[model samples]
Target: MASNDNDNSLIAGALFLVAGGIVGAGVALLFAPQSGTKTRKDICRFARKARRSAEDAVEVVEDFKDNLSDIVEEVGERATEILETGKDMAYGAKKKLLKALEESGEQLEKQRAKLSKLVG
Candidate 1:
């Protein structure tokens, strides 16, 4: 979710930058004492640069998304492995506890029988 938020923020920031650049360019053109031909050329050049920048931003996002996916998958796999290892350890511990309890009960039974004969 945090990654998603960051992605959204990056996209929003890129869009804002592009929008601001275009607006600034337009204002500059309007205030400058340039002919129509020069202004048109300038606008065209700025548009091309903007398009490239937008494309670069998209590529950046794509790479980030791909890297995030790879990281998520790796973490998921590690979590699964850790869970399985914990289960195996728990099972081993349980078996040991049960064996110890059985041995203890048998010893108690033997001691009780021995005491009963002596008491009788």
Candidate 2:
């Protein structure tokens, strides 16, 4: 659980870094001297790139979330299966023990009857 939290934190940090870098680059471009038309075009290009990068990051995050959910569900199913199997095995063992006990009791009763007949 701690590891999962760490992984999530790392992903968040990486996304933040990418966003910060894009913002910093845009700010730097704004300060640089250039013709008005060229500057506007550059800013527009940078904005578009940043938007695309953000969208990609969001998609990656969504994919990670989906995969993690699937893994959790799979683990839950496996655990349930293991529990049920254990229960079944225990029940089977109990039944076998009971059958053995009944047979032993019957045998002892037969032996006692035979001994009484001989004594008589």
Candidate 3:
């Protein structure tokens, strides 16, 4: 998944570089003493293409953001469930220990009473 993101970033960067180059070339042409009408037309065309490319890039970034958010939420939920399960297990173990201790104490008291009866 990380590699995929890296790949996407690289592709987006390359596309931006190409778009910049196109705009730069168009600007250079516009300044090179061309007919005013032709220069305007060329600039308009380049502007439209650049706009489309930028919108596409925005869409890609939005999709990546949404997917990352979903993954983070899922991980958070799983972590919470695991924590709850651990707490339940700990509580059960503590209860079992307390019960065992109570039983042992009762047995000791019974033995003491029997011994006292014999001694008295």
lDDT of each: 0.90, 0.87, 0.84
Q: lDDT tens string, model 3, 1-120?
A: 895787578667857776887778786977788799988888888778877877787777768777877898999999999999999999999999999999999999999999999999
Best by TM-score: 1
Note the residue pairs that clash in candidate 2. Answer: none
Model 3 lDDT, full chain set = 0.84
Model 2 CA lDDT for position 70: 94
Q: By the lDDT metric, which is better: model 2 or model 3?
A: 2
Worst 10-residue lDDT window for candidate 2 reads 3-12
Note the residue pairs that clash in candidate 3. none
- The order by descending lDDT is 1, 2, 3
Score candidate 1 by TM-score against the native: 0.77
Between prediction 1 and prediction 2, which has the larger TM-score?
Answer: 1
- Alpha-carbon deviation at 53 in model 3, angstroms: 0.9
